[model samples]
Target chain A: MNQTKFSSWIFDSFKVSPEGLGLYRIFCGLFLLFFLLPSAGIYPFISSLPHTFFQPPPGPMALFDGFPSHSVLLLLHTMLILSICSMTLGWNTKKSSILTGVLLLAIKGFVYSVGKINHDFLIIIVPVLMAFSGWGEVYSVDAFLKRNMQKVEGWVLTLLALFIGFMFFTAGFSKLIGGWLNVESQAALGHVFKQYYVVERQDFLAGFVVNINSPFFWECVDYLTVIFEVGFLLAIFHPRSTRIFLCFALLFHFSLMMVLNISFLPNFLAYAAFLNWTWVDHFIKQKAANTEVKSVKHKWLAPVVIALALVGGWAIIHLIGNDAVLQADWGLAGFIVISGSLPIAIYHLFDQLKRWILERLK
Target chain B: MKKNTVKKIFIFFLIFLPLQYAAVGIIGLEKSEPWPAFILPAFQNVDATPEDVLVKEPVLSIVDSTGVIADAVPSGKLFMGIHESQIQGFFRAHFRDSTRWKGKNAEARSWLANRVNQLYPTADPQSVNVRWINRYYDLSSARRRIDSTRVINEFSISLRDESN
Candidate 1:
């Protein structure tokens, strides 16, 4: 594919609707404000645990007694809240998005070193992409003031799609390391399940599993977890693949919720919103338009698109494997890779499904 | 220049405001010498004592080595019921009816009082009055200097045996 055609394809894939941008800004702004209010002691709420499962060894109880009283922490949180609010309101939206992103990175760095870091840290990518995508063009204070704003192009949406996919891809690759691949690693599963049961006593599914007393059931769970996590990148690259994978991801999370009684599955579901719903719609529309056009000469574009998708998918998976933090948890790292790539997978899957359905109807 | 002016104003207020409040709070704290809440009660010196005394044929004449009458108990065939009621009330007022103390009869309170008197024979029982002291002063500072040469002035009167 020529540079012009490739560039155009990339640009066409990312364009987003005004409504999508508005939704993004609103949710991101609200999330920041919600966390900031509690952090500042303005509204005392049940504090979320800062410790990640992968945190380094136990330290002094006094050190982990509560949130830090440092002035810098307060300043950073205040800045983040203001920036996100401004971005949502569309007042100097681009600058606010950039500021929010930078402040988030700074705060994450400070908190991650002391507290346990979660996969939610990947949400930072949204603001970073929004800063460049000119997402403030719609549903912003700026758009209201200007009265006339150009619609966002496809490239912006594509960037968001890619970012989401990369997140899941990285997570999947991270889990492929160490004893995670072994079918006999029932001990690790037992440990995680026990922790889940203790934290959430209503594990009806887990109780059944425990009563059955079959080692084979545990082995099946162990292999299925690794496969679903590692297969995320493949499942997300095509529409049919993604539909299958989405079911798998959903089932994976649901089973964990039922058996392990973990609450993080809801958070994962929320992040899946970055998938390329627009691309799917575009593919469907384009395929319908192509049916009537005589002498359609864009057959070569299909191969190029496939190759680009593969390369992009492979690159995301590679990045996940290389990430030092994800690699630390050999058993769970594959899930991290799959999680990183989930956004991209969803977007591509939508695009392929849209195109296939449109062609069949024509 | 306008931006610089706004920045300067912000920096000035930010640096000065917290310091001003902090300085005032620290000064107030230092002036108060505020003690921890739990430690305040230890400084209160509340004396425990009672007024009445009973006289009878001395069963045990407890005295210090200098031969001063510190304490004494009367011998038998007395109104044991009335004597016990008074002694039990005295013990209850001082010790709050603790299970550790055996308030069996009049003999128990007398036994304990006699033992205390023997140890400090010169301590005039009449002189031992309950006095409320100022709480602000430390308990260690209120210790009395015992002058061994000085004699106690209070004396016990012997009541005639009514049964005889």
Candidate 2:
């Protein structure tokens, strides 16, 4: 194909409907907000500490010589939460999304200033990009008020897919280069596992993997993990391949949650942004029709259920009150696994129940 | 933000992408290179390395003006919901590196001064000091006892300058 034709094809493929971007925006917002809820108490915690304890990361370090006053930190955190809520609710969404992104970056810098960076950094990038796109053009209050139905450039979703795909691919490949693929010793996974278990001595779930009877089996699985991650890029080539890769990725993250006690739900949700959810929508509609239930009645059902589950889980954890129970090897592992799987399981159950009710009506 | 340009750039980014992290992994293996945040190398062999050279256990204690010693409160208990790693990392950042030890100690001194002031609002302590205990534990041992003698580092702050 000629260059002009190729460019046109690429442009056309990257153009996504307003609904697609809006759905992606919603997923990103929900994942970030939910993950951040538990950390809301951090403001008061920081306030009680000495100002010297606040070692702002490089960017913010340049901006301020000392820690901001307690009132300012509290104000910033409150605004962060409020903006996240506004972004998710699709009210003044574009600005709110941008504000949320900025707040996430600022909070991350503040938290990491003292010398620890975490995996949640990837979560904000997609939302920041969404702010600049046409995501708020549909399935949003702005869209509802304006009656806008314009198609946005599809690059936004594609970019999100690439970030998720490349992130895992990079993680896996990084291990490979560090000699994870070296079969002679198969010590890479053992050492990585030992880092948290032995060095950090903070084991909640991975201790089981550390104590596994068959070392060779886990080593082989580690190699397979690298292969799966490196091979993830194939998903971007086609929808079917992307779906297949996403399934494997979800399983991989679920397994990681069990063994490593780490949950990558934000990455999983970002992966969903790449999928054409028309099929899921059709399924919901068909079920709603059979049951003679207005689908709009259930539109807000998923988010409401998720919020309730999260609040209930937090309350239970607080009531338990034993730090040992919350941080024990088995206890922490179980909590992560249940928390990670529960929402997805509940959503599926709700969908199936809706379908079952419609079938009975038929 | 032109649609055509964005599509082309993304295509370029995905081109030969397997080598992108592969290169980063190679650079990171040496442990001295400045790595871009969020990038990881392919093989990070953590266990095979000798733990004696890599790990140091930090024990913190507070010493009052009269030299009375008391166990420093754990940051996790104080913060009341932070991950264990965050609490550890916060202190580790202060204790681990020798070059920055003084600066970190000065900061600790300021914190201890403020803490003492808060605890004794009626009469602040004349001096408050923080003592850092560094001990190395050999993982290969069955008991995991301290491999070396405990090394003590101390920093003090005076209440006379606390108002400043």
Candidate 3:
């Protein structure tokens, strides 16, 4: 636990190739411009509402008397789109990334002002943290602008994992303290019933999950959720265990999508950092060939491409004609695709975790 | 960046672990902390217990911007699937704030009028009205039976508010 040991541990745990980092950068940009940002329409949608509903929860947003004017909100939304584009292209890495985070924070702050806060912390902060991760060292405008690039530091990825783990750990602990363990009451069932009967979010597998009214099953769900969430933080200290926890996280989020209709798939952006993407780069080698040449060619064209995609995404959202774009949560479909037959994946994850525990015990 | 600087940053990041605990548990600011707090509250409480015959639900009546009055839409429908999850907070705060004028909460009316305006933008004039719907579920397990629901408490606020 000495200084050098701690520093080495931090660096070694998160190390990835420059190409890997570059690919991840592109993945983030594409994910935002396509998957997450189109939903940015919701910000203007909410801001355009009456100011009487602008009562923010206790935060910096509470300082504002009312919602900003449509013009101000439109400006923030515009800046947000541009910032995401800048961060994606790795132009002015640190500044653009920070600006992206700040803009998302400000806008989401306005949204959370409407009497709720969901788990958007990771996605909002990833751009800012990755800026410092030296992700810009390769395949970036910053890198292209420089003759020589310093070694990319891997600490930021580890730091991000720490954050993810830390938040999960707190949530898990809070659940345990908040009576999730009570034998008489089925806490998970309570939530299932609420999301089912009360909220009427009964699309997909929600009806199926609700019918299994076994108190035993609900209790097991309660216990396992706490273990998985809390174990995330503890597992981060062990590289192999961290991978196992991340694997469980995939299943966990998919379960949420199915049972409760909550989508945390956006978390993949942060989790992508913990992966060693050298193999992915190798597998996509045919596509990776002369990426630098293509990137240079696309440098001037990237923003234009992004702008088109943004316009197209908004067009589709408006076409849907309601806020159904927000409700449909197309991102959750990624979970279904990744974890095909979610029940089987859950069983597999549990089996693997049990075997892993038994191996360590032996 | 220098290795020393990286190490210092790492230490600072590590320190965040304790700082967060202090902010949430010790300082007890979990509910108030800026931006991201560990607000993943346990879904401990049931929405409505099977035994509890009556469940309270909010119903909204609104005059659209085009001056069409539609009565008794589920309150959650007002937002039209945008963050339907957070309605618990909205319902609790503006509706059931514990008898400071339980059904007659003015903020609740203003909130509804605003949404009506947003939903039917450019309509001549809109009004907001809301009442409670208490209903019961009719199903039983081996031994447990849930009561029927009937909550039609009248707390009608007619707020004519313009969008700012």
Candidate 4:
């Protein structure tokens, strides 16, 4: 695409109103509150809570047991629960989001070092991003009090998109490290399948996965995950592409939920926060009367926006490279990447295929 | 000011109040119990032989602030049993202020030593070895010495049969 066209698209995508931004904040706050309910007392009541619910995983315990007490663990859980609750209620949501993100990161980091990291750990990154996005605008008590409210524009939205995209891209790039490409190391693919199927006891989905057990499948899964993750950077710049990618992500999560019983619901909810609040703002319009869109023509703004996006994208990929750590289970990571990225890829592919068929018929 | 924000905040506080209350309630209920107690059966009967008879005199030890070890009367019996609750009570009362041995493991051994002394006042105290096998945590961090909320500690008491 030409720079002019790219800039215009970027400008249009970021032109979300304060009300729309507020809705996004509210949605994110509510999402965190709801997701955290499981880890609260409600989790023990749930039969499906993972076995590691009551205590830290053995690996984490071995590493963190040296701490003065389990007070830190208890404190982290307590702070997270409080932050989510406060954010949901829109009571000091900004403060809550920041605290929630920090506490969540600390706990997740400590836990990850201990040997078991849940897919939900990535959800913490969303709140960290949202905290800066001025998400406390509408559904929050601050919005009610008419205090510290500010209008958010295209730049904020673009930044959010970039942040989300970077998360995927970094995860993908990390997998490519340590010569995951070599034929000999490609045997690790079989190990991946065995680890997921036998060790993890996820045999229910083993049939679908095992069928694609060839070296070709392994290499494809490896490279595809990296490409799709990094490809998300491109999608974020293209709003239309993002809509397609979002659908793909949903489908990916759905498949993981169905096949492996592992769904990154938090990350999905976080992505939802970055959406242009046109629909929700419209729905909530009757409750308050400021839902009209004001269109403004700024032809020069487009190119600037596009330039910013490109710079942002490069910065994101560079940052990802600096911190990228190769994971032991790149195959599993590949599977996750496929689950997240394939939805967009498949949708786009289907659209292209349909267009080709129509053209042939014509 | 948006009316929706007011409504949302009110609803949030409504939920928060009840959860905070419930958490406090649970923690309060847990604190009411002075200590947790458990009972394990001894390998043999205490009344089988006169040589295995346990003298009722309890030996008092002031050196260890936790409890006094009672000497046991040498009986030819294979095993002896004591009430877990009674042992736990002695440790809780004696070591209520000691800092060094405050956890579940410490409490369990202290209780067992006292119980052993209570059972046999005349027997060699060294013959009775109190080994703590399993540990349980209450609200306290039983594993850590600092700011631990551990409640009940358990221990196993074995009498080495010198006659054997």
Candidate 5:
């Protein structure tokens, strides 16, 4: 590509207004508060394990003694909820986003210390990377108070696409190395079997998927999985086709949820950043023009709302309990987290329909 | 500092992080850390029934100087009402990947020794062995059979001075 094409690839291809960033901030914040936060409930149980079981990773993770005591883990959970609330409300967004990421990373650090690491790195790192994206510049409590607001740079979204693309690339690389391309082996079918037989994750369509004894169908799935993952990096070079790629990813996550009972719902928040939220920013800006920042008079509004969010998060966490957390599969399944995510999915569907109708009329 | 430099850093980072992660993991099989979800294996298994899938269960032994089982480690009981396989992950992470964090490895081994003695009180355990009990899960039958058991690695327990 020429210099101009390369420059446009990083800057022009991924343009997001401040309000778009704010909308994404709201989505991410609420998603973590309502859907993602409850998954952390399992930390108390994992933390309570005998100290002998603690396995810290190499590098910075080695600095820790192990998973903290149950009390400390609960403290981390509380701080996480608060920061998530602050971040969602767009109050001190950068700091709150950073804090939210660090807290979640720390808690999840302990969670992964047990040996198995789930694909939750995307959700954990999004807030940290995006804290620099000026997401809190508009539609936030800080913006209302006229804090240090700035235009949300388009470059950040481009960078995020790169990060997310590389994540998927690694998955494909790992699978290729692990023998997913072998004709004799169907990784997807084998995974379905593993989930069913060993882990016993027979939820949703898992029962039906487990019964399909066709080698051709399973092999096709294996190839498609690798292609979709590996193709993501190459596809992102244009960024115009990102929405199409993201649609495929949505289908991929949904299939995993339906067939294997594995949910990557949290990734939707990360994917939201890549979407063109310019329409949302325009709509919200139009609304804001008529309606003054009325809540500015009510100094307690942010705190009251955050406190209520905290209460809601607390209630959700308790409702999760041991069995619920297990059923939620640490919020990586369609149970607890999906309850919080379904509304957003429904909204997106309606929005897409509206856009299609509008385009037809035009 | 500059916007151009920052962009270069981000670009460089994206390339470096995944390549290094995949390289380390591919080279070091069991010893590698899958932290922060850098690598996604996605089951990478052959299409086989549950029985055909061979799974390894990590087992621990608390033995005396005579190589006799003085008391059971009861690793399963550590986390109440949790799956044994879930608990086995702890053992796998500690022993299989010990080479990465030697200090923590020794610390965990010694702690395991103390735990054994604490439970039995009179076991006088000298060392601990965290080994893999290989088994197969028959997919059609949904049943598991122990194929074999072998000692993977052993660590000497830092026995506390009883007089102290």
Candidate 6:
């Protein structure tokens, strides 16, 4: 293709359904909520550590000079949890998503301030991009509320894919620079496994595989890693190529998790952004074709009721001051009931209001 | 936004991607400026002969003044059922900087002491020690026989303030 045609093709390719971004947003938010949020419970212990222990990285992260106090940590955690919920449900998504990203970065900064920085940057960047884009326009509470067909520019998804691709390319380039391809130097794949063995974290299977000590096998793995990572950028424009890389990436991550016990769940979920979802979008449209009417009327009632019920229950318990209720585990029950249903209720209510508004406007 | 404008922005960002890697890989700008999110592209696969393998792992022990070891178990395993990488990360940081080792060791000693006190509060405070029983293979031999294990780098920490 000529330059003009190529440029136009690239621009045209960037157009994607907002539903795709919504899917990415919801999955990422859920991953954060389920997998990452619980880890914040350690904030109390982390907060107790002396300030000198935190060797904060330079730039924006440097703001975290010392760990936050327990109360501040708790507050940040609360905000993060709330933000995650809103972003997931697509309630006030633009603001909520931005909040989620900022809070995520803040939390990560505090978490990694001690010494090493974890490679979970994608989880933060993607959401921030979504916040600015039209991600909330479909497959979300925002979409349900707006009651309008919204088409997001494809650039948003393209940028996210490119970010991941760039990351892999850099990773491969970095390995090349570090001489990972040179097997004779003993500083390649074989050496990596040996080091892991020395560190004594090797799983039975990993240990067995590394024990073979076959130079040929080691060389293949070493070269494969570099080639796959460096070549990942090619998958960005080609859907078929993306599937292959996606499978390879998933396998690589799973193997890493199995052998090394390193969990990058957020990054794993972020990979879903690369999917075109043309079929999934069609299926969603078909499914929603029927319910588009009733969904409008009932959106506001459920959330209002759920919120009041939770508050009233809490108030009644406080007024009663019954130790029996406490002993009966009512607190835990209330927590489970509220935390479990609040997101769904909020989403329902937001959608209902959107449809109601749209009806009135029509 | 105009289509042309969006295209221009896309192209600019596309260019920005490689320029970033170049900054990190070639210009060392990322290292000097140290953008918090920008990871310097460096891969490490350290090679070592079988002789470098530690068959017998080291232990960091807390022994009381009366010579009784503290009740604290040496669990270098990962926390919350995650893989060993997390625990390895804790140790890797200590090993990464020789200059900071002493300070880091002291911090670890204090943390361990506090943990032991919580476990066995009645036990009197004591000195902490890191002992390594090292054994490596004699790979040069056809059989690759394991060498006799010997104690190596058995360092002891005596806290000036036992309370710390």
Choose the strongest candidate by TM-score. Answer: 3
DockQ of 3: 0.31
Per-model chain B TM-scores are 0.19, 0.48, 0.47, 0.22, 0.50, 0.50
lDDT of 4 at A183: 43
The candidates, ranked best first by TM-score, are 3, 5, 6, 2, 4, 1
lDDT of 4 by residue, A116-148 (tens): 234454466566655655666665677778886
Return the lDDT, model 6, position A84: 85
Reference interface contacts recovered per candidate: 0.00, 0.33, 0.28, 0.00, 0.32, 0.27
For residues B1-164, write the lDDT of model 4, one tens digit per residue.
24344335434543553453344335425542110001001111111111111111122232222343432222211112211112222223333332313322433344444545665556455433222211211112222112222323322232332221
lDDT of 6 by residue, A1-362 (tens): 66776565555545566655665566567656654453554676567666656656555767656778978878888999999899877888888888988888887777666555566677788778767666777657877788433456666666666677778877787788777777564344434443344554443245555454555665677788789888988776654455456566766654544444333455654665655544445554555555657553442332333234544654565576622232111232322333343354445446656877999999
lDDT of 3 by residue, A31-120 (tens): 666556635446555765556556576657878877787578788878988988777777886788789888888887877776666666
Question: Quick one: ranking by DockQ, best first?
Answer: 3, 6, 2, 5, 4, 1
TM-score of 2: 0.71
Could you give candidate 1's per-residue lDDT for residues A1-362 as a string of tens digits? 45555455455433466555554555455544532222343111102222221112122222343434456567777788888778767788777877876777655444433222234433465566566555566556787798435445445444343333444544444344435445444533443433332222233365555343444665565566656665665454343454556545655554554455432422332344454434543464467467876444353233234334434544565565532332112112334434445555556557767988999999
Q: Compared with the true structure, what per-residue lDDT tens digits does model 2 show for residues B1-164? A: 67667767767766645564555445535432222234422335533323331233354444455564445545454335455546655665554544444444355555655655555465535664445554444445433444664546655545445332
Candidate 6 clashes between residue pairs 3 or more apart in a chain or in different chains? A14-A154, A15-A154, A145-A354, A299-A349, A299-A352
- Which pairs of residues collide in candidate 5? B49-B139, B50-B137, B50-B138, B50-B139, B51-B137, B51-B138, B51-B139
lDDT of 1: 0.41
TM-score of each candidate structure, all chains considered together: 0.44, 0.71, 0.78, 0.47, 0.72, 0.72
Whole-model lDDT for model 6 versus the true structure? 0.58
True lDDT of residue A271, candidate 4: 59
Candidates 3 and 6, the one with greater DockQ: 3
